[model samples]
Target: MSVKNKVAIAGVGSSRVGKVPDRTGLGLAAEAAKRAVEDAGIGWDEIDGLLTAYSMTEKYFMLGSVMCEYLGVRPKYAASMVVGGATPGVMLNHAAMAIAAGECSTVLIVIGENRKTGQTRDEAVAALTTVGHPNFENPYGPPMPALYGLVAQRHMYEFGTTSEHLASVAVTARYHASLNPEAQMRTPITVDDVLDSKMIAEPLHLLDCCLISDAAGAIIVTSAERARQLTTSPVYLRGISEFHTHEHVSMAGDLTHTGAEVSGRAAYEMAGVVPGDFDMAMLYDCFTIVPLIELEELGFVARGEAGEFFAEGRARLGGQLPVNTHGGMLSHAHAGAAGGLFDIIEASRQLRGECGERQVNGAELAVVHVEGGVLSSHCTLVLSNSR
Candidate 1:
């Protein structure tokens, strides 16, 4: 009778992840949607709901409606979400709620962008700077890295975390990416390489930051009843939670403590599971320090201890918790909000035992967490192969 077990991710799809200058945002989205529809084994017209995020390269009045029309499917419900990296997880929660509320049966969530190929470096930086407050933060001309840099600086100052600790996180992500053929950065890197990389912001080197790529991904959310009838591998949505703390990093109550603290606990409580119950995790790694902070907030490790955890190899594959096995945004392809959806896609694949070399053996339960807008908005999800 629980709605948690009632909704399942029936299918997921992603276009070629790395830079593709020829592909438009809409083209990538269409390709991913087609694959998701085929993977779900559902007719396009059968979809009753559609959800999407805005594209960095393309602007539209109603993106979800535009996407539905572009895909040749009209749905009873359509919505566009914008919450930076947390958009995908938020859309999934909304999709599940729409199904549980009887507003829609099958919901399709899609997002993508040509961030790498669509805009020049200056344009991309300018677009990203818009996330800052125009009145206060934007006047200072601080980019996203500067915002995250502030957090990293504070974390190090308060927790005594060192540059070496941050470098280990980048090393781990690149190592995992080496196993994933579809990953944008596949070459393995070491802590020394991470430290030697050009410094973007204080305490954050080039390797500490995530990649910018052209990518698109789609997901199918349907009732468990429908999912059972369609595919043998159905990843159930066990729990989900979303929260917004502040619009700008300057307005945040505490730079070190993100909304993940509240949302992660809410999601785990809803799913009737704890941190240890998850076999794998797909954390939004916009920066190396992000996963460290998020893992601490999620109670995967004690606060002020994530740096040591990474340094000790606790977050790597075959360790206590394998995080961002698909390399995450740090090593994987990040294309606007769609980059976050890739975390869910990878979690679904892990639960289904679809990841060949990167697969965590017997990974039945997984966690996908993403935060957006200078860690202002947060979303956490718990998924399991078993209901």
Candidate 2:
């Protein structure tokens, strides 16, 4: 019998999201790692490999060296990845492949960034330019919010994607966030308020962009056999795919769309599921326009039809396709790459029905969409809670 390699997420864990204090970067990371290991019913010594999407946020170079020491792990293999939001998802795929190939039996993938304590949201914005292809984009003073606004502008022009529609997204997300105590923007928000909020860039308002907050999240991957013993119910990764548009902002393959199309297609093919199969989706909402475009690319709606996709309440609770039940980056905390890591965590939680007020009803199969680096990189994962 030919055995298929099935990687299972034995644990899903997160640190307190938003404006966390009294904790250093290493302290938060170690707590998350310990929680994940405990959630997996395993010991740190059992981990032979560790993969983290850090360095950019770890900003502290010794993160890996210190994290390992704190976790009581002297792994034979340890490497940090720097793939934006796609970092954790991609590193997970890498760890899964490694486990299946006998490279390692157990691996931990963790990500965290203390933007609040380490740097203010404005400070983070100033540093956003550093993530750019310094030579080409930096000289243009292309602020991250403005860069995303540029995409929003083109999306509206080409696809008839409206500012109101984008406002609907932030409004919807905050509505969900109000149900989540952990969400950063729990205060009641409205589409009218979104429309009236301060404009950051044309077509992009303060509500349209996700908040920058200090946060940490982690996920554990192991072989199917080990997963069976670790948890009563495990969320399995059906498929994983990643793509990068271009190294710089000027090379955005297409402003109206994203490289998510390419990666989304790959993962959907691997998972043998189309848009119709997804009960829920936790799409990366770096900007409101991002998920709007993903709805078109992922076949959730017709191309140029995402404007109307959320129209008539389709993307809301008790609608055709409920989304971002634990709030999203917009209403939740946005911790750089860890933002998407929460997307994955929330997808799993929704699948497990563990989410309190924000839980999606009967979500068995879900998609976690994550993108980073100014819409330059994308990652997609199809996860199922089926045992």
Clash pairs (backbone) in predicted model 2: none
Q: Model 2, 1-387: lDDT tens per residue?
A: 111238888887888878788665666677677788888999877998887766444555766665677677888767777777777777877887888888888888777777778876677777876666678878778777888888888887887778889988887788888998888888877778888989988889988888877787787888888887898878888878888877566877678677888988988888878989988888888889888988787779887777676655788878888878778999988877788888888887787778877778788899888877777778888899763
What's the lDDT for candidate 1? Answer: 0.91
Cα lDDT for residue 286, candidate 2: 82
For residue 347, give model 2's deviation from the true position in Å. 1.1
| Model 2: CA > 4 A from native | 1-5, 55-57
- lDDT minimum window of 10 residues, candidate 1: 1-10
Superposed model 1: Cα runs more than 4 Å off? none
lDDT of 2 at 179: 91
Candidate 2 overall Cα lDDT vs. reference?
0.79
